[model samples]
Target chain A: MSLLTVGSVAFDALETPFGKTDKIIGGAATYITLSASYFTKENNLVAVVGDDFPQSMIDDLNQHGVNTEGLEVRVGGKTFFWSGKYHNDMNSRDTVEVQLNVMENFDPIIPESYQDCQYLMLGNTAPSIQQMVIERLGKRPKLIVLDTMNLWIEIANPDLMSLLKLVDVLVVNDEEARQLTHEYSLVKAAAKIHTLGPKTVIIKKGEHGALLFKEDRIFFAPALPLEEVFDPTGAGDTFAGGFIGYLAKTDDISFDNMKRAIIYGSAMASFCVEKFGAERIMNLTQSEIQERVSEFVKLSAFGLA
Target chain B: MSLLTVGSVAFDALETPFGKTDKIIGGAATYITLSASYFTKENNLVAVVGDDFPQSMIDDLNQHGVNTEGLEVRVGGKTFFWSGKYHNDMNSRDTVEVQLNVMENFDPIIPESYQDCQYLMLGNTAPSIQQMVIERLGKRPKLIVLDTMNLWIEIANPDLMSLLKLVDVLVVNDEEARQLTHEYSLVKAAAKIHTLGPKTVIIKKGEHGALLFKEDRIFFAPALPLEEVFDPTGAGDTFAGGFIGYLAKTDDISFDNMKRAIIYGSAMASFCVEKFGAERIMNLTQSEIQERVSEFVKLSAFGLA
Candidate 1:
């Protein structure tokens, strides 16, 4: 099975209580593809970046088993850059700058080889661009997971609504889920979302945890309680990657398997916050991941009999 | 094994998005004893109420298998009363009025029979009063679980610190846990609390879930997602009651047993918010409780292999 990810791949400057960072390689697709590489070898990235982007980062992706053939490089254009400052509580942040240079008119040009992808991940991007990527596919993927933010739900609601019907799973934060449906209760918000589209909904509650709602069944995964969150740059994207990556490797979409995938996703995300950017995730061993997964089992495991 | 609960049993008037309630039978011990009654028949209550309090509610407690011999009624005093308005999000509320008529100078006198109690629950109250109850005990109970509020943490700092050393387990909400230790991270907060005393700590996160930290292990229980939360008053007390009650009934204080106790406690709290006051918990059948516990098993159970 193959996995395709299409979203932003750019530079980010971040400031947290711990310290600040210079321009670091951080983006939805970058985190997604890099994270997916840990679970699957046939991970493919379909995102656009400017010529100013470092070739070393692309080589890093290749070394991690991510195919960068579909990643486009625009000549003589500035790379998409974002700068933000996290509050004392790392849960909320303020975006100080966003330059959508190459991302201004990102056309997700699907490669012929990517037509074999069975799992497609539409990372955080404009709903219109996400829809375009879906339409350009030669054949629909077996599973489509879409991640969106409040900005799209507010400004491009119509596009987002239509795009929702085309995807199988919708991933959003707790606030976005409430804002999108105007329903304070997440169970009710998920029910309203099911009416529009996306039968499966994952509401990420930052440090609290994540919930998976499908039909009449619901599953919850707890976030690992860490001593400190050095930087929460791409935790959500990393979670999404681990989720779909495990699914692609296992090739199962049943609710039971999704439960296991969420645990894997959560384990990956716990590592994402350990250091700045993707530094920790970039250098994880198989045993380290297995040990982390076992920690989750220990953190939540209980016997009833 | 007998369970003793010592706290306020008074009246509450609540206003919420769903509707409003007149002065209904509400208090920490009212909810705690009522919830624990479902688990243990030897449940004893020690609290002071006014003659103005209804006899029907006392009879209701007796009917629920709770021992009311220790519940004292003062002829000339009025019952403690609380009034609050829940915000649009039922998570936060505004305390509009408080009349500590009988509770102003309350005395928790341990009865001869209650001295045989193996488990004791000191519900939310002044830290000084909670400590007095423990000091009056002839012999230490097998297990002591204490629940406290932010007010005591703010005003009675020394008393709370001393009380913390006297208890086996401590229960507090996420905010209070953070405030008590000046640590934003719950893992760190629980760690800081360990040095203050109590080997076990349970951090309640309202609708999010509850986390149990003991020794080097941790366990999480998810809150059942509901369509609506009628009232959130006394949910934490209900959780504490269910937790200690189950432990008393089974007479097991091990960490593994505590994990199961948390699940049962979480299920009981799920039923607490379904209606106003203690109405929903008053007449629950054994089958309903078992079914709800099974629902929790379904909500959090996942397989890795």
Candidate 2:
């Protein structure tokens, strides 16, 4: 099974109470491809960067079996750049700067080879761009999972809502779910989301964990309690990558398998926050992930008889 | 096996976004005894209320198999009363009034029948009074679980710290766990609290669920996803009641049994918030509770292989 991920590739500068960094290779597509590569070898990414982006970074993706043929490079434009600061709590953050640059006119060009993609994951991007990629596809993938933020839900209401109907799974944080449905209770929010589309709805609650809702069933997976979260830069993207990637590899979207997928996603996101950007996610061994997954099983395991 | 519950029995007036309530029979011991009564016939309550506390309330406790022999009546005083307003989110609340009349000089008096109790659950109260009850006991119970809030941790550090050494288990919310241990990460917070004295620590996260920690093992039981939370008062005490009461009924303290106990506790707490104060908890049937516990088992069940 193959996984296709489309979003942004950029440079990020981050500052946290623990430390600060400058211009680390970061973006939704970058984290998604990197994290997904661990589970599925045929991880294809479609996004636009600029000549300012390092060739070595593209080579890095290739080394990890990430097919970057669909990644466009605008020779004269700058790569999308963002700067943010994490608060003392590490749960909420402030985006201090964002330069659209190469992403301003970005239109994903899916390669002919990617037309046969089996799984599609639309990272956090403008709903218009996400829908455009879906329309460009030659045929529907086995599953389509879309990730969006509150900004788009508020500003691009029509586009975002229409995109929701086309997705098999919709992923958003707690606040976005509340904003989208105008319901404070997540159970109600999820129920409302099911009516919109996306047989599956995932509400990400940072350290609290992720909730998976499929029809009437719901599964919750807790984030690993870390001693310190160095940076939360790409945790959500990494989570989506681990999630859909595992599903692609297993080729089973049953509610039971989705529960395991979320556990893996939580494990990947846990590692993503151990360092700035996607540094930790880039080098996790299968055994390491297996051990972390075991922790999750132990963390949430109980029996009734 | 017998279970002894000691804490305040008072009245509370609450206002929430859903609606407002007049002064109702509400107190830690009241909820604790009522919840535990469902699990054990030998549920004994020890606390003080005023003559203003109606005889009908005593009859109600008796109706639930809650022995009120140890409950004192301050003939000239009014019952302890608290008033609070829940914010829109219902996560945090604001205290509007606190009238500790009979509770001002309250002292728990254990009845002769209660001295043979095998389980002692000290509901949220002043650490000094909790200690007084423990010192007056004829013999140490097989297990003692204590519940306390941030107030005691902030104002009675020495007392709270020393009392932690006396109990078999301690229950506190996520914030209080951090406050008590000075560690933001709950995993580390649980570890630090372990060094204090109790062999087990249960960190309650309200609607999020409860985490039970014993030595190197950690178990998390999630609260059932509800359509609405009518009221959240006394949820923690009710949880402690169901937990120890179940343990007393089974007479097993193994980690595995504690895991089941927490699940049962979570089910009881889930029902607690379905209606105002203890109304929902009072009317739950054995089959209904078992059904809710089955839902918890289903909510958390997953396969690793």
Candidate 3:
């Protein structure tokens, strides 16, 4: 099974309590591809960048078996750039700048070879674009996971809702889940959001962990408790990559498999926060990933009387 | 194996996002006794109340097999009364009023009949008061569990540290743990806190769940996802009751037994928040608890691929 992800591929300047970083290779697609690369080699990338985007970054993804044939580059424009400073808690942040130079008119054009991808990840973006990608697919993928934020729910709720109906899973933070449902309790929020369309709803709580709700069943996978959270820039997108990547590798959508996927995703996310702007996750090895997953197992697994 | 608990038995007026409650029978000892009562009938309660405290509440505890012989009644004095209003998110609250009338001068006198108790729970209170109770015990219990909050740590840091040195286990919320150790990450906080005397530290995250840390080993137990959280008051004490109650019933303090205790505590707490005050947990049956435990089992139990 091949995994295809579409979202921002740009530059980011991050300032965290621990330290700050200048413009580095960062974006939803960048994080996703790196995390997913750990699970499988059959990965396809789709996004619009600009001439300012570094060639070395592209080479990094290509070397990881991520096909960039669908990556569109506009010669005269600048790549999307985001600059943010994280608070002491690392969970909250202040956006210093957002330059959507090339992404302003992003029109994802799916390549013919990418048509056979069995898994699709729609990173945080406009709902219309997500719908366009779904429509262009000749046949529905085995699983379509959609990731969105409070911005889309506030500006394009109707369109987002329509797009939600076409996806298999929806991932949003706890606050966004509540905002989308007007419910404070995550359990209530999941109930209402599941009724909105998707069969499964994942409410991410950052350091607290993530909750997976499907019908009458719920599974919780805790984020590995760390000594410090250096940066939380692309933790969510990295989580999505590991989740979909694991699913593609296993080719199983069962809840049991999804539970492991959540753990794997959580492990990937734990590494993402240990460095400034996705640096730690980029160098994660298979053994390190397994060690983190085992840590999660130890953290959450307990024998009951 | 008899369980002995020393804390306040008073009334609370709580205003939450869901609704408001009149003076409800509350207090650390009250919630602990009720939660522990579910596991065993050998519970000895020691606390101070006043004439204003109703006999009906005593009768309620007596009905649950909680011995009230050690409960001291101060005639013509007011009971400890606390009034708090929860924020819109329900994760935080503001203390509107705190009248430590009877509790101000509480000096717990352990009854001769309770002297044989083997398990002890020192609920959140003034550090001096908690230490006094521990000193009054004729013999050191098999396990001594202490609960404290930021208030005590801020006002009585030296005394609190002394008391921590005497206890086998420490229970605190995430924020309190952070405050006590001046560590931001909970994992780091637990590591720092564990070096301060207690062999085990349980960090409660309220709706998120709880983490039990012993040396290098850690276990995470998730709070049962509920559709509504009517009131969160006393949920932590309730959890402590369930936890210590299970340990007393089984008379084991091994790491495996501690894991089971945390799960039982998590299950009881899940019921505690389903209704206003302790209304939902007050009449929970064995079957109801079993069902909730099964739900918790499903929520956290998953096979790894």
Chain A TM-score across all models, in listed order: 0.99, 0.99, 0.98
Distance (Å) between predicted and true CA of B122, model 2? 0.9
- Model 3: residues with Cα > 4 Å off, grouped in runs: none
Deviation from native of the Cα of residue A171 in model 2, angstroms: 0.5
Share of the reference A-B contacts seen in candidate 3: 0.95
Better of 1 and 3 by DockQ: 3
Compare the candidates by TM-score and give the number of the best one: 1
The residue-by-residue lDDT of candidate 3 on B120-224, one tens digit each, is 999888989999988988899999999998889899999999998999999999999999999988889988888898989999998889989999998888988
- What shift in Å separates residue A138 of candidate 3 from its native position after superposition? 1.5
lDDT of 1 by residue, B1-305 (tens): 89999999999999988899999999999999998988899999999999999999999999998998889999999999999999999988999999999999998888888887899999988989999989988999999999999999999999999999999999999999999999999999999898999999999999989989997778888899888999998888899888998899899999999999999899899999999889999979989999999999888888896
Question: What is the model-wide C-alpha lDDT for candidate 2?
Answer: 0.91
Give the alpha-carbon lDDT of every model: 0.93, 0.91, 0.91
How big is the positional error of residue A280 in model 3, measured in Å on the Cα after superposition? 2.2
Ranked candidates (TM-score, high to low): 1, 2, 3
Error of 1 at B97 (Å): 0.5
TM-score, per-candidate, Cα-based: 0.99, 0.98, 0.98
What DockQ, between 0 and 1, does each candidate earn?
A: 0.82, 0.72, 0.84
* Consecutive 10-residue window with the lowest summed lDDT within model 2 chain B: B296-305
